[model samples]
Target: MTPRTTKPQMSVKDFEELARRAPEFVRLEFINGKVQVKPVPDGNHGEIVMWLIRRCMQQRPELSLYPEQGLKVEAYRKGRARPDGCLAPEENFVGQGEWAEPGGVLMTVEVTSRDADTDQRDRVEKPDGYAASGIPVYLLIDRDACSVTVHAEPEGGSYRSITTRPFGAVVELPDPVGITLETQKLKDYAD
Candidate 1:
């Protein structure tokens, strides 16, 4: 008879504990009871993230932007996500723990990396997760496709509206964050 073996599923608590103990260079996330790991982003990714942060700060001084902040996307699910950029009211994180519950988060941004699975997660699974968590916006920068996508209007565990634009175009963010983002400066990973 063949030996029976099964991979152990990690709970949200377990994931959080493991992530806390992980090295600073490692990025860890729990998605649908599965642990996902990735190395720290490259220079191009950091540049784009900083660019977006600067732009958002210039436009909305009252809001707070954090990079790679862990977020609780669902209470019932054993998963925690660390978005590339997270926008929220400054007060939301006051006296909070390491992971912020997705209550006052206005938007989350993801800049795709070289991995196809990473791109797919940003394009598909993440939107659903963010929406279900009541986040208002999910921005995806697709390096592979040279496009940016904004998803909003969360309902039924998904965003009801989506808009996509090429790298050179100006994408208008929705109200409450009424600002236009210039994507022309966003160079592809190959650059």
Candidate 2:
């Protein structure tokens, strides 16, 4: 005899209810109709987010890089996700609750975590989700690959243009998010 554990596929409303009651130590996301457990940030991950925050503030002072923002995503806004950072005009989320609508979001930033699902969650599913939500840009800081990939020009549930630049290069984030990043500093946090 084997002990069994069952995982039920959750709807958006159910997922939100569970997430609300979940302890602070746990972070949850729903993508592609599956419940995802987002791991806590390690020191390196925190450092990278901090680095990006500084850069975002310097280039676009009117915007803010909000960390761990829960957003309603996917087609029909049926999916829920929490990007590592969400870039939008300052005070954009003042009146919103837990899962905010994706409008007015200039970009969604994800720093790859050292987890089994990083590739699927960060690279594949998330870009699709953001693209489907019509967010203009998706920035992925790939620590393992020592690179940064920018996904822009969302259309038809995907980005029309995708560009990847290795760490230490001058990367342009494209229009709607015209910030140019000097990612040489990212090389330092690639642990």
Candidate 3:
């Protein structure tokens, strides 16, 4: 049987209290009263996140990094978001509290899993959410397809720059955060 997709309706406040209090199972972001439970990424996704973190640490040791972490945004609604991994420019922002506040985020990454709906959520809905909140960079890693998509320069309600890197390709983020990504390492995820 197909798992039912409809989530119980919730007010933003109620959702916040419930998520903060829940003990087991992964919780997720609620948009317009709808709930979404993010998938627990497979081993390949975990490896890729670790590999990317390692590379970023080597190239930009000054930045604080977060993996599978959640952040509180939408202050009134008390909504939150947890990206697969993220980078913060300096030490002050790296702490135990929420980390998804707008411009405070230098970059956010999402490693696609086996679910098509989840992929669409990351590729479409997430960019909208991130861009609307002013996150400057969003990186998407698609190991199943061996590709990377970078979304930058938010305009209106969406990101202006969209670049895809296929397997064995190299892609570079713009200045300030001039980190070059090696797409080839992504292919090793398949092994």
Candidate 4:
């Protein structure tokens, strides 16, 4: 006879309760019926996020910036998936109202950590999710290899390989937008 093995799979409500209860600690997400806890932002992660947020804010102070916040992109679906940084275009920006709108964000940035697998997820799965949700640009800052990968041109359910820039290099943003990333800052905490 084969040995039986089992593990608990948490529901979205359970995860939400956990997040609320552990608000002071780590933020949790329910992905594929699994509870994924995001690592506390180390110094590098925090600096990068802050830099991106400042840049976006300076460019368009009128637009709202949602950084690493729980975003409910669709009804009946609640995922604690927080992008390292996200910029909501003026139109769909969550206004100073009661409930939050699913901000039709123009860009979502994910800064990779020491974990190699998470980097892969950010490169592959998360971009797919962002593209599926109509995000125009997904910038990935990979500290592990010192490179910046900008995923765009969402076609069919995924983004086509638009362009890739190395560390200390600057890549021009596509049309309708003009943004630039400073990879030099990454050298500080680069793995």
Residue-by-residue lDDT tens digits, candidate 2, 71-97: 999888888999999999998898999
Candidate 4 least-lDDT 10 residues: 1-10
TM-score of 4: 0.78
Clash-forming residue pairs, model 4: none
TM-score for each predicted model, relative to the true structure: 0.90, 0.95, 0.84, 0.78
Best by lDDT: 2
User: How do the residues 48-141 of candidate 4 rate in per-residue lDDT, one tens digit apiece?
Assistant: 7787778667766865556775554322343446677777766464453322334467777888866545754566657766665656778888
Q: Best by TM-score, which number?
A: 2
1-191 per-residue lDDT for model 1 (tens digits): 11111343766778889999999888887765567785478899888889889999999988878898888874344458899999987777777677877878899999888775785467776787788787888999888778889998888778888999989899998966676898888855425
Compute the lDDT of residue 185 as modeled in candidate 2. Answer: 93
Query: What would the per-residue lDDT of candidate 3 be over residues 1-191, giving only the tens digit for each residue?
Result: 12222443866667777767766566576642456677777798899889888888888898866886675533232446778877777754555555345456788888887776675577776776666666788888876767888889976657888898797888897655678987787888954
Stretches of candidate 3 off by over 4 Å are 1-8, 73-79, 92-96
Identify the superior model by TM-score, candidate 2 or candidate 3.
Answer: 2
Between candidates 3 and 4, the one scoring higher on TM-score is 3
Assess each prediction's global lDDT (C-alpha) against the native: 0.80, 0.91, 0.71, 0.64
RMSD, one per candidate, in order: 4.9, 5.0, 4.7, 5.5
Decide which is better by lDDT, 1 or 2: 2
